[model samples]
Target chain A: MSESRNVSIRVPVLARVEGEGALDLVIEQGDIKELRLRIFEPPRFFEKFLEGRHYAEVPDFVARICGICPVAYQVTAAQALETLFEIDIGPWARAMRRVFYCGEWIQSHSLHIHLLAAPDFFGCGNAIELAQIAPEEVRRGLRLQALGNELMELFGARSVHPVGVRVGGFHAAPPPERIHAMREKLAAALPEAEALVRWTAGIALPPDAQEFVSVALRHPVDYAIEHGEIAASDGLLIEAAAYPEHFVEHHEPHSTALFSSYQGRPYLVGPLARLNLNRDRLPDDVQALLAETGFALPSGNVFQSMLARAVEILLALREALRLLADYHAPASPWVDATPRAGVAVGGTEAPRGLLWHRYEIDTDGLVRNARIVPPTAQNQARIEADLRLSLLNFGLDHADDALRLHCEKVIRNYDPCISCATHFLRLNVSR
Target chain B: MSANASVRPRVAVHKFSSCDGCQLAFLNLGEDLLTLASRVDLVHFAEAGPLDADAEVDVAFVEGSVSTPEDLERIQRIRARSRVLVAIGACAVSGGIQGLRNGADSASWVARIYDHPEAIASLEHSTPIATHVAVDFELWGCPVTGTQVLGVVNALLLGVSPRDNADKVCTECKRQGYPCVLVARGIPCMGPVTRAGCGALCPGLGRDCYGCFGPAESANTDALSAQFARLGLDTQAIARRFQSINSQAPMFRQAADKARAAGNE
Candidate 1:
C-alpha cells in the first residue's frame, strides 16, 4: 500500500446501532481528507407534531422518539412539565421514577455490551457467533437484559413503549408484592452485572486514546440518572434552562440529523462521560469492583466505553435495589396538574447520555412549541472527530474492509441512537 | 437442538424511519433471542451486528414506515428478496406516530425542522410498509412485543399460518377480569374499537387505552367517539384520540375526520 494513493470508503448502511445511518470517508495522500457519519435516518418532525398536544400526552408522545431509551424521554418530558406546572411529584413518585430509569440503563447498557459492541473485539460477526464461542456469558447478558425489561414492565405495564408515566406522576404503582419480586431479581442480578464489569475490562481494547471533553448530568446527592444539572469535564455547570445558550445544534449537508456542539467544539456523552464526571458518587462496593478490575476512571481510551457501560449496569442494579428496598403502594399515583402558560425545561441522563427537553405551553395546556436535544445528536460531531483521529492512528493505508470495521466499532462505541438524533428542529430554516 | 443452519429459515430484521422499538422486540426476547438465532439463520439484523441488507431471507421483519425516498426503494428490494415479508409495529402497519404528519402540511413541517429542507430526502407522507410494497402479514402496536413477534416467527418456522387476532382490547380486558376504565372511572378508553395484542395493557394499569394496536376488525369507531363525547371529551380531544399512534389506519383515519367534521358542524 502506497501512502500516495487516495482511498475512499463508503458504508451504505451502518449495522448494529439504532436507526438508519451510513458512513463516507476519504483519505487523500494518506491524510484523512473527509469523514461524515451521514445519519440518513429521516426526520420524524416530532417537535412539529408535538404542537397543540396537551401536557399529559407529552410523555407517551416523546417516548416514541427513541425505543431503546423511551423511559429517558418519558422522565425528561414529565420533569419539564412538572416544573412548569409547579407540582410536587412527592418523595414516593421521585424514588419510583429513579428505579424505573434504572431499568432503562440496565437493559440498554447490557444490550449494547453483549449484542452490539462486544462482538467487535472478539472477531465475531454478531452475538450469535459470540454465543457459539462463549454461551454462558452471552446467556448471562441476555438474562440481565431481560431482568431490566421485567423491572420496566413491573411499573410500565410493557417495557418497549410503556404506558404508565403521566404528567404529575405514574398512572399506576406496582403493588408491594411485584416490587418485592423485582427487588429479589435485582439482587440476584448484581453478581452477574459485576461479572460483566470484569469481563468487559478484560477485553483487548485498542489503545487509541484521544482528546475530548466529557459531559453528563450531575446531581448533588447522587450519580445523576433521572435528574441533574448539566456538567462538563471542562468545569462548566448549568441548569437545563441555560442549555440552549451554551449548546448549539445545526444541520450538516450530509446528515439529516443535527450535530450538537458545546462552546463551539465536539464533546463526549454516555456511560464513559458519566463515569468520568461522577466516579466518586458510586457506592463503595461498585467502586471496589472497578478498582479490582484495574479500570481507571476518567479514562481517555474510547474503547473502554464497553467497560464503562458494564460498570453503569452494576451501579443501576444497586440503585434499583436500594430504591425498591422499602416498597409501599402510594394511595394515589399521580396528583392533579392544572393547565398553565409557561416554558418548561428539564435534563436527565438517558442510558446513552444527556437527554434535554424544552416545551412551551398555553393556558389551555396545549403545547405551543417543543424542542428536544438527544444525546446521540450531541455526540455526532464527537463521533466524526473520533473517526478522523482513530482511522489516521490505525493507518489509512489499511484495507477498506478493515477501515470500515474500525469505523463501525468507533461509532457503535458511542451507542449512537440515530432515531433520537434526527428529530431536531432548526429555528431558522430557510423556506 | 436446532436444525442445520443451511436449511433453517433465514431471518432479517430491517428498519426505516422508526425509533427501533419494534426491531428491539427481537433483542428484548432476551434468552429466547439466542434460541431463535440457533433455530434460524439471522443473516441481516443490523442491531445485532449482521449487515447483509441484501441477503435473501425466508422471513423479513420490517419495522418503521417508508418516510424517505431511499426507504421507498429499499422496501421494494426487501419485498423482492424476502419470501414472506412481515410488517411489524404501528409504523409498518399504519405509519406509526410519525404518520401524524400525513394530515398536516408535510413540506412546511420539514421547513420548520431542517435548515436545508432540500438536503433532507423525505417523502411528504410517512407511510406503512404495505403502502409501498406487498406485505405478507402485519403486526400492530406502537412497538410490537417480543411474544407477538416470536409467535409469528415460530409459526412461520413450523410451516403453520400465524393466527391474526382481530378481537378488540375490551375482550382481552374481559378475559383478564380487568375493570373497564371508561365505565368504571369515566376515562375515555379506546379499548372498545382498538385491536387486542397488548392484552389490555393500559386498562390493567388503571389507564385508558390509547389505541397503540390500531383498529379492530369492523370496529365501530364512530360509536366509540360518540361515547367519548358523552364522557365530556371535546371534538378535538376525541379526534386526537383516534389520530394518535395509528392515525393512518383506515378506520381511525375516518373516525378522526368525522370527529373533526362534527366539530365544524
Candidate 2:
C-alpha cells in the first residue's frame, strides 16, 4: 500500500531572493508527473508601463524592476538607448561603467554565496544558523558583502537603486579621493574574497554533473559585464540587436514567467554560463586561482554555480581596484542623448546572469515598446529541468521532508531572482 | 531553536509586491545584523530563513505593497499574528514604484507586456498597507537606509515611539553645505518636497532628487512645481518627477495630477 501511494508536494517558497512565487510538484507511483515553479509575482507589468516614458527615464524605470540588480537594468537600458542614438560614452566613461558593474557583481554574488546558498551546503536552516556553526566564515561573507555594497556606494551613492546611472553615462563622477578610499577598503576585503573561492571550492557538494547548454555575453578585451556579444556554449553568436531573431519566449500557463528556449531546448545562464563562455577573458591571476582549485571550467554541476559566483567576486574586486587607482572626473557626466526613432538592443551580465533589453524609441524619444529578459526568467526552464532531474535522482518517493529540503537546495543553487521571476512558493505534499 | 521565554521581542519580516531591497536593508547591516538578532528574536524572514510566517511575534516589519489577492490575504494574516505591524519603505507607506499604475488602465498595463492578460492575478492597483489594514507606523524610503531600519527596530524593542525626523531633503542638503542642484545647476529637483533620511544623496552627487522617500512632513508641492516650471521643465516633465517612486502618496499624487492637468491644458 505504501509503495502504491501517489506523491504530491507543495513548497511555498516565498521570494527568498526578494520576490514572491511558489512550487507545485506531483509524483505518480515514483514517476514525477507535474512540477510547476509557479511565479505569481504580482505582475508589475514593467514592460507595459515603460511605454510613453522618456529615454532619460529608462535607467530609473528599469532599475525599479530588480532592487538586487538595479545596476544591470540601469546599464542595460542606458546602453540600449545609447545604441539607438549611435553615441559612444567615451573611453573614460566606458571603463568607468565596468567599474560600476564590478560593484554589482561583487555585492550580489557575495550575498548569494554567503547568505543564501551556504546554509543549504552547511546543512543548516539559514545563514544565521550557519553563522552559529562557522562564525568567522559568516563574518567574512558579511564583510565581503559589505565591501560589495561599499563598492556600489562609491559609485551610485547607495548599493540599491542608484540615481547616478543615466542614459549615456553616469550623472556625475566620484572624486579620485573617494575612489582611492574605496580602493583601500577593497584591498582589505580582497584576501577574504579569494578565501571565499577556496572555501566554496572545498565545500563537499554532491557530484551531480549533466549535459548543459550555457549562454553568456562575450567582449573583445575584458571579462564581459557592461556590454558584449551574445555567446553560447553551443557555439551560437548573435548580434545583441538580433536576440529576438534567435530566442523565443513562451508563457507557460502554470508559471507567470515566460520560459525562454534556445531552439526549443532548455539552456543555462548566469555565473556558470558566463565562466564557461569567457574563462579565457578572466585575468591571469583569476585563471591561476581557478586552476589552483582543480575545478576545471565548462562544468556541468549546477552546484559549482556557488564556486562560479565566488570566482566572479574575486574578479570584480581586482577590476574595481584597477579602475579606482587612477579615477578622475569625466569631462562630462553624460553625452548629449538626442534620441531618434530607432530599435536597438543592449545586453549586460547581471550577477545572476545575462540581462537583455531592447527598446523602440519614437521621434520624441518616448519608449514606443520595450522587451526585457531578466536572467531568472531565462533560467526558469532550466530551474525546473534541474528540479525534475535532481528529484528523480534523489528518489522522489522518499519522505516529504527529505525530498523538500533537497528540492529547495537545488533551487537555491540558481539564486533565482524570484522577484524578477513572478515569484513565493509554499510547500504542500499530498497523496 | 530557542524557547519563547528568551526575553527578546519576536520580530518577523514579511514581503508583499515590492523589490526585496528594503528587507535587504536588514541583512546589508553586516555585523549590525547579528547585533540586531541579539536584541530581537527574528522568527520569520522569507529572504533570510524558512521560518513560519504565521508565528506570533511582538513586532512585525512589513515591506512591499498589496498588489494581488494573495497579498491582501497575506497582509491580513500577518496583521493578526503581529502585535505591532510597522510598515517599512515606500512600498509599504506609498505603494512604491508599482503604485504608478494606480491611475493607468490595469487591463492595458497587463496586456502591454504579457500576451495572456487572463493569467495575471494582480489587483487593479498597488496600494500601501494603510489602505487595507491598520498600520502602527511607517518608515518611508524607496529602500529605507540601515540607520532608519535600526532606529525603528530599537524603538520597538524598547517600547518607545519611533522617531522619524520629518524633515525635507533640502534641509539635509543645506546642512551638508551642498549648493542646491536646482538653484546652482538648473537641474529640476524634488528635494523641496521629498523627505529626508536618504541623506540628500542625489543633490550631493550633483543630480536631481527623484523623491525616493515620498513627501516630506509638510511639503509645499505646488510651490515646488511652479519652481520646476521656472527652471524650464515642461508640465509633462514636471509630472514625471512626481510620478516615480511615491506617485500614490496623497501629496505626490496631487502634485502629479496637477502637472498632468497642466500638461493637458
Candidate 3:
C-alpha cells in the first residue's frame, strides 16, 4: 500500500475515558482531515434537577455526577454554597477538607496511572493483563489507591459517593484514634506513591510539542488543590468568582458538551497545567526528584500529561501526611449555615484538572441556578486539537492499528472522566 | 458453582444512563478487583477495560437506568447474553438520583437546561432495569460499596445465592451504637424506611439519612412520615425528604405524593 493512501479509521468505543464515547477519524492522502472524539454518554440533566432543590442538597446532588471524583463534586459544591452563606468553618475545617481532597487526588490519580494508563504503556489490554507481568508493582499501586480510599472513608463513612460531607463541614469528625490510624496507613503508603512517580517517569513518552494555553489554580501558601486564584500560562489571572466573566463555553456544531475557551481559544487544565503553573509548590525533596527524573518543565507536549499526574501524586501524598500530622477534631464538625440570597463560584483542582462550580441561591437557601464545568469537558476541544497534531506528528503513514493506538494514548493522557465529560456527542464522519 | 473447576464463569458489567458510580463500586475494589478477575472470565466493563458489547457472559452486573432509546435496546441485548442478571445500585434497582425526573415534566426540564435540546435524545422516563428485564438479584445504594460488590462476586464463585440485607437502616444504626438523629436531634431522617446496606452511615455522623439505598422490603414509610409530621416537620419538608436519591421507587414515590397531598389538603 502507498504511504499516501487515504484511510478512514473508526473506533466504535474508546475505553478508559470514564464513560461511553467514540472516535471517528478520516485521512486523505496521509493528511488527517476530520477527527471527532465523540462523547455520546447520555445527558443526565444534573443542572435542571438542581433547580428548586435546597442548597443543602447540592453537595450530594453533584457528588452523583462522577463516581471516581465524587469529592471533587462534593467539595466544589460545598465551597460554592458556603460562599453564598458567607460562612467559613475556620482553620480546622479547611485543613481537614484539604486532606480529604488529597485523598481524592491520591485514589483518582492512582487508578488512572495503574489501571487505565499503565495498560497502555505496557501494551497490555487492561489492568488484568498488566497485573500478570507486574504483580508486585500493581499490588503496590493498589495499596496506594486503598490508602487514598481509606482516607476518604475515614472522613466519610464509605468511599463511593460518601454522604458524610455536609455543606458547612463534615457530618462527623473521626476521633483521634481514627485519625492516628489513618496517619499510620498513609505513612506506609508514601513510599509506594513516590515509586509510582518514578515508575511513570521511566515510561517512554511520545514525542510531540505544541503551544496551547495552560490554566490552573495558583496558591501562594501551598500547591493549589482546594482554593486559589485561577491563573493561565498566557498571564490570565482571575478570582474564582470571576470565572464566568472571562471564559466563554463554546457550543460548536461538532458536539453537545460545552467546551470552554479563554478569549476564544481552547485552554488546558489538569495535572500538566497545575504542575507547569505551580511546580515550585512541590516540596524540596520532590523538586529534587523532578530534577533527577530528567523531565523538562513548562513543555508543550500533551503526552507529558501523565508525568504531570505522577508529580501530583507525590504532592498529594506528602500533603496528606503534612495535613494529618497535627490533626485535632474541630470543636464542632460544621458551623452555622444560614442561607441568604447570593451568587458565587467555587473552583478546585480535581485529579484530572480544574473543576469549577457556579450557583445562584434564593432567600430560602434553595438553588436558583447551578452551572458545573468539570475538567473533562474543558479538555474536549484541547483533546480534539491534540488528536490532529498527534496523528500528523506520529505520521499518518503508520498502520491503522498503530495510528488508532497512538490516538487512544493521547486521549488517555488527559485521564478524562467521561461520566463527567458526557455533557454532549454526535459524529459527522464517513469511513 | 459448576463442578468443572477449570472453567471460569463469564462475568460482565454493563452501563446505561448512570454516573458510573455503581461500576466504580467494582473498580474501587482495589486489590480485590484483581482477585475477582482471577476467578471469573471478566469479559466486559467499559470503566475498567475495553468494551466487548457482544460478549456472552454467565453473569451480568447492570448499572444505571433505562433513560434513552439506545439504553432500551442495549439492556435487551445484555439480558439475552447473560444467564443471571443483577441490578447493582439504586440506579439499576430504582431509577437513581436522576430518576427524580420520572414524575416531572421531562420535556420542559430538558429544554430549560440543555442549550441545544434538539441535539439531546433521551427517553421520557428513566426507570430501573427490572422494568425492562428480569433481575435475578439487586444490590441497592446510591453507589454500592466495594464490600457489597465483593460479597456478590464471591457468592457466584461459591455457587450460593448472594446475601443482600433487606432490613431497614434503623437496624444497622442500632447495631452500630449510634444515637437516632431523628429522636435525639430532631433531624428528618429516612433511616426508618431506607435500606440497610450503607451501615447507617449518615446517622453515625450526626446527620440524617437521605435514603440513598432506597426503601427496605415492606418498608413502613407511612409510619415514618407520620413520625416526621409529629416531630414538627411541615408536609413540604417531609415530601422533599422522601422524594430523593431513589425517588422513583414505589414506596418512596408514594410516600412523597401522600405527603404533598396531605399538605395541599
Residue ranges of candidate 3 with Cα displaced over 4 Å: A423-431, B1-6, B112-116
DockQ of each: 0.82, 0.52, 0.57
* Residue B106 displacement (Å), model 2: 1.6
Model 2 regions lying over 4 Å from their true place? A1-5, A423-431, B1-5
Q: How well is each residue in A1-431 modelled by candidate 2, as lDDT tens digits?
A: 36566878898764345576678888887677888788877767677667788888879777778888898888888888898799988977888888888988988988888788888878887787788999999999888888888878877899988878887888888887888788888898889889989999999887778777999999898898887899999899888888876777777766677888888888899999999999999999899999999889889889899999999999999998887776778878788878899896889999988888888899988887777888888898999999888887777668987877778778888899877765211111133
Instruction: Give the TM-score (vs. native) of candidate 3.
Output: 0.96
Cα lDDT tens digits for candidate 3, B51-150? 7878888899998898888888889999999998989998899988888877678787656545677876788888999999899999999888888888
Docking class for candidate 1: high
**lDDT of model number 1:** 0.90
Q: Compared with the real two-chain complex, what DockQ does model 1 have?
A: 0.82
Among the numbered candidates, top TM-score falls to: 1
Question: Residue A401's C-alpha lDDT in candidate 3?
Answer: 91
| Candidate 3 per-residue lDDT over residues A29-83, each given as its tens digit | 7677789988777777787678788888888888888888999989999988888
For every candidate, C-alpha RMSD to the true structure in Å: 1.5, 4.1, 3.4
Q: Which pairs, if any, clash in model 1?
A: A16-B46
Provide the overall lDDT of each model, using Cα atoms, as 2-decimal numbers. Answer: 0.90, 0.84, 0.84
Candidate 3: deviation at residue A15, Å?
A: 1.2
Q: What tens digits encode model 1's per-residue C-alpha lDDT throughout A214-304? A: 9999989899899889999999999989988888888887898888898899999999999999999999888888889988888887888
Using TM-score as the measure, name the better of candidate 1 and candidate 2. 1
DockQ of predicted model 2: 0.52
